[model samples]
Target: MAYTPELSNDQSRTLRRIAWALNMPMTKAMNAVFEYAGNIIDKKRVCAACKDNSKCNTCAFNQKRWSGSPHDHQKNKELCLLSLIKK
Candidate 1:
């Protein structure tokens, strides 16, 4: 998805609110939220490797390529959150 810069302020505020409400560090909260969201999205999107019977290396959304490698779908979710924040 494309990033949207228009909502950066709003996203920042929302993140702050979430951090405060959960009584967690902002970065940790953000990471957890993004990871959870990413897993949900991954469940819906077809796994790239599964489609081709090839290794994850060739898949565009390969989980291993992310920060949380092997379980990196959260990284993708973080990217999505960043994009939304940019909006």
Candidate 2:
């Protein structure tokens, strides 16, 4: 068995450009993208008023991250990013 990475045409081109700009491999470029996006999502979605930082197990926002279907998570992530762009 073998595994292969796949991307849409636009995604592939964008990733290649990122890789070129960073002088890094595609995998690293993709990982960088994921980290950047996750930071945006976390900063936006995590509770801002909570003083307890170690209570993720009981936090509603953290709990929701584990409960959704993958499609739902992806849609929510896209919506979150889009909302940031629209602001």
Query: What TM-score does each of the candidates earn?
Result: 0.43, 0.44
Candidate 1, residues 1-87: lDDT per residue as tens digits? 267445388887988887776667778767666554644457326563256545566444455555354354544433333333433
Which structure among the candidates has the greatest lDDT?
A: 2
Question: What is the C-alpha lDDT profile of model 2 across 17-74, one tens digit per residue?
Answer: 8777666787877765664454445533457756777866644446455465423554
What ranges in model 2 sit over 4 Å off?
1-5, 42-87
- Model 2 clash pairs are none
**Candidate 1 overall Cα lDDT vs. reference?**
0.55
The number of clashing residue pairs in model 1 is 6
Residue 63 deviation, candidate 2, in Å? 11
**Count of backbone collisions within predicted model 2:** 0
Model 2 TM: 0.44
Q: List residue ranges in candidate 1 displaced over 4 A.
A: 1-7, 42-46, 49-87
Q: What lDDT is reached at residue 6 by model 1?
A: 53
